[model samples]
Target: MSAQIKNGTILLAEPFMLDPNFKRSTVLVVEHNPEGSLGFIMNRRVNMRVDALAKEFPEFDAPVYFGGPVGTDTVHYLHRKGDLLEGSDEVMEGIFWGGNYEKLRFLIDQKLITPYDIRFFVGYSGWSDSQLQEELEGGSWVTARMDPNYLFKSDPEKLWSQVMENKGDTFSVIASMREEPSYN
Candidate 1:
């Protein structure tokens, strides 16, 4: 509760969290305000792709991320193609979420935006006003500074622990723990 949460902060799930949707999840907070907060789970890559779901979309091959349990019917995206994608809102330094959809297709078709420059999500994680604050108070998450490069550059399977490891010291120790500790 005392931590200063803001857009671009990485929300790391606490070790051994029980929520199946969020255990070992790493989320990028895209919006924060009195109304609520919204973000996409950065580490969960679903077994699907953009063009697979929408044949109309150009033949773009890339991993489709599972943003969260909310709004599975819709698609959302995060990217670093600020001006190239146009009308994008900066979630933080170097990271931008959303823009003109038509322009996105055009950029994808023209090869102006590469897979390295963006990530698509099936849905997003949302928190309502006091809900996030309550979660923070309840020890469900740990906040860390974001290095936007980590989004596209880091291995998704290791993201949660990798990010936690980057925080150093005790966090590194925690990161070394197996996800299913009982097996050990």
Candidate 2:
């Protein structure tokens, strides 16, 4: 396995990942390095409403996403406005992650940023340095470069299947299979 995963890519877990949190999950790899990896689950949608968060933070406005199983209470965000803010890091081409509450508030108040332009996530996927590398070697994930269009997709419910289908013939077949293949 490569020591580092190319940034701004998708990590699709193999069907064998029995962990309910990750089974058939699609993750956006925002950071991958010797220090471990961090990403947000792109497929899972929380039941919470954006207005609820907007009321709570008042300063920030963005739709929340299900990051992963870890740090469920923590909030994170991904945006294309990396260059406009301090402390933001690019995870892939045209995609950036991190939070600057003050800057976010300013952007929101000025109407410079909106929920449509960014995604908020609760918690994040984390791997101990070297742990992700091992998983890669074990075939737990298949990596693909990121697509900006997918990041801001309006319909996340189909995003996972869409991504897997784009992986070419092999994954297309898998994507077409029914979730309960045994019944077929």
- lDDT winner among the candidates? 1
Per-model TM-score versus the true fold: 0.96, 0.88
Lowest summed lDDT window (length 10), candidate 1: 47-56
What RMSD does each model have against the real structure? Answer: 1.1, 2.3
For all candidates in order, the CA lDDT equals: 0.90, 0.78
Clashes of each: 0, 0
Q: How close is candidate 1 to the true structure, as a TM-score?
A: 0.96
Candidate 2 segments whose C-alpha is farther than 4 A from its true place:
1-4, 54-56, 59-61
User: Tens digits of per-residue lDDT for model 1 on 4-100?
Assistant: 7899999999999999999999999999999999999999998988889765799898889999999988888899988787789999889999999
